[model samples]
Target: MNTEPEQVSLNDLAGLPSMATLVLTVNNRHARRILADLSAMLDAQRQVMALPDIMPVSAWLRQAGDQWSFASDNGLAAHTVDAFGALSLWRQVIIEAETDHALLDVGNAASLAQEADRLLSEWQLEVPPALQTDEYRRFMVWRKAYRQRLHDMDAEDGVLGFERVYQAIVDGKLHFDFQNLVLVGFNEYSPRLRGVIDALRAQGVAIFALQPSQVDAAQVERVQAADPDTEWRLAARWAQSCLRANPEGRYAIVAARLENDVALAHRVLREALGADGTAPAVPYNIAVARPLADWPLVRAALCWLRVLRAFLLHGRCEPSLAGAALLSGGCAAHVVEAPAGEQMWLT
Candidate 1:
């Protein structure tokens, strides 16, 4: 048996049987692009059949876990906790570990600790015993407590779930229905995930890595601008020119630090695209993710909630809180007109 995974180009996927499953280790956006290209290729070939199953690794793991649960008697599938649940549990453990003093930032600390724990699991590494720093000791204690909580709750996070599935596969307790498994955009894999892939290959599953097709190098242009504003404006103008040349063609403008400079990029793109101070009906799409709390509507809702909480706790709302709620445009005329002694509550 070949120990190494077989490699194939992206174009080679067109020859794959429709039953083949393509798994991607990329974000949703990149996955969508790959899916679109694959669909277009199949359409060009006039192949009218069900497309191959393409999905991200997380979704594939969930499907595999479900299959394992169905085939095996083990109840490992019942104890899986999602990312949010795992974070909440980690925060709870951190809070419980705080006996001397309160943490400066509980949320940030929890996030970091959870990431550290995940890294340890992913790399299958043992915690170092040489350097015994105060923070490290504290984290070690929190980690122990967190694992104990998971044990008591019979819960496992994503890392543990992957390991469990891997073990099941290795022990011949799990079986896959598909014959072909195509891996895409997977530059690296965790030890446990790699183990699962090896076990699948051993079971006669055809594993292939989709490589990028070789092409001539594109022309590179470097432009020095006064600042980011000028840079974005120049990019927008270039994009507009491209659109003018090929009105029906698709294009993308990539900003490396888009998340950090989303507002600036949006403003610059809108102005350059000839839609300023109005709803941007431009052909381009700007995809930037932000926390829900950063949205104005969510902020307004939170302000209203704060006002309601103050009123419930003290039997009267603070003037500052009420003013904030009113200014947020979250308060209605009925709320403003309600009598002070009416015992109002926000539903």
Candidate 2:
């Protein structure tokens, strides 16, 4: 049975199957509220049982290795694209009847070959007779060398790969002190995550997952016929109108592609406002991704800095530096050559 927010008090926590560790998968805003509520309940009781070491899953992973730097301590972020690429290549290789013929169609033949070899070693699958071909034999040699490189890197305390971390937990090499574990708001779990969960269960650790189902049933009907060019702008204007009329009320602009449409709406509204780029003074909580790499202002500043440094040191700047800056700042049309012998000094 799922525990309700109000029903789960500090006193009632003692009766839960496993209260030693409570791992919650919550957004930062909701996490703060939950922490505050838990603290209040403890204060009211004026007593403590085995107070669970509550934490988010990612935080818990870092704590297990006693490392806080995600970039330096782990290669998971760096190799994410590569790992996915590896899987894609594996699917092609394993599925194809004629491996050599299939490889001819691959854009990155080298990467496909490399991943195929890695799979042979890491996957631990028996080699089928169909794969025992001249093309497969050629790929095996490169895979052996790559496997050695991985082994050497591991011996030298290299950054832990994402798969490696999952394997460690499953193999009982990595563990926390918590005797019992509780997971909150974890509805969907990846295969690696499931492996770790299964391993924990095998260790006799009581595990519970509290997942609350959330569904959005709001619908939008276009008052006018759809025009691809102006539909988004019209929607933004409507949203702006609604917010302006009722400043105290909360509103949401639902879109099929929030990441793309919300960003476009923000720009459209800003443009419609004027040169000052001021929109309606309404609070917005855009439920979309804002990846750091996609932040134009920050990217523009970095590119500008690089250009400045390059010109100062070498008496010339790469075209890319200026190009990146101009594109980021939305002024690509006005990009001009850097003045010769110009010195830029920062105090």
Candidate 3:
């Protein structure tokens, strides 16, 4: 038996069999890009066929968990909660604790605590005793309450969910339909994840890690710019040239620190692509994500809802002048208008 990592190109995905499973990058966006690249490559090769089971790691894990839950005899699925549900429970625990003392930023605190709990489980680390810091003590209390709450609800978070699925697979309670599994763009795996993969391999499943081929030295180029703005401008120009050279070809311009500089990069790219002032759609897309509440429309909607709730509860909407202005700007009609030093009452 030969033991060597499989070397596969993006073009190789075009030849994957229907029964094969392909696990892509951990990031959904990166997985989508890989899929798009594979599609384009297959399209260029004139191969029109159904692709195999392809998904990101997160998606694949969720699918595996669902499959395990469905195949298991016990009703373990009903007791499992996703990440969001787990975070909601953590927030509830923190809120309950806040009744005793004031806590700064409950949402952020819950998120951090949830992440710490996940990391502890992932790394198989025990909570260290003798944490003398005030914050650590508080976190310990909150964690105790949170665990009690989970016990009361008979719910397990994602970390425990993964472990349960792993055990199910080991005990032959879980089975996958695919005989062959291909992992792509994965650098490392946590112990629990590795255990599950090992269990699958033990069950006569063929697992292969697809190693990316190296790029030729002549084909690679490095550019040094004076500043970030210059760097983005150059990138935009390069992308524009690539599109001009091959109008039918797909391309992506990756920017460093894109979340911080999306607006500047967008402006530069639009200008470079000659779509700055035009009403026509832009040729490229930026993939930076923002919080839902960060969007102006969402903020306005939430503010209006809050105002309405206030009005219904106390027969008055007591939104600040700034909030009133935001409401007016978002809606066609002003819901609450507060003038200078004036109390506006609604009945």
- Provide backbone clash counts, one per model: 0, 0, 0
Backbone clashes in model 1: 0
Query: Candidate 1 lDDT, tens digit per residue, 215-251?
Result: 6748778899999888888988888777767778887
Question: What would the per-residue lDDT of candidate 3 be over residues 111-190, giving only the tens digit for each residue?
Answer: 99999887866666654577467877787788889988877888878877766766787777787778767777767777
Question: Which stretches of candidate 3 lie above 4 Å from their native place?
Answer: 1-17, 20-25, 29-50, 70-84, 98-101, 125-140, 213-226, 234-252, 275-282, 300-347
lDDT of each: 0.76, 0.54, 0.72
Q: In candidate 1, which residue ranges exceed 4 Å CA deviation?
A: 1-3, 20-25, 43-45, 71-79, 131-133, 213-218, 275-282, 296-347
- In model 2, what are the clashing residue pairs, if there are any? none
Q: Could you say which candidate leads in TM-score?
A: 1
lDDT top scorer = 1
Write candidate 2's Cα lDDT for 160-211 as tens digits.
3435565667877665556666565555664555677788776766666544
| Cα shift from native, residue 152, model 1 (Å) | 1.1
Better of 1 and 2 by lDDT: 1
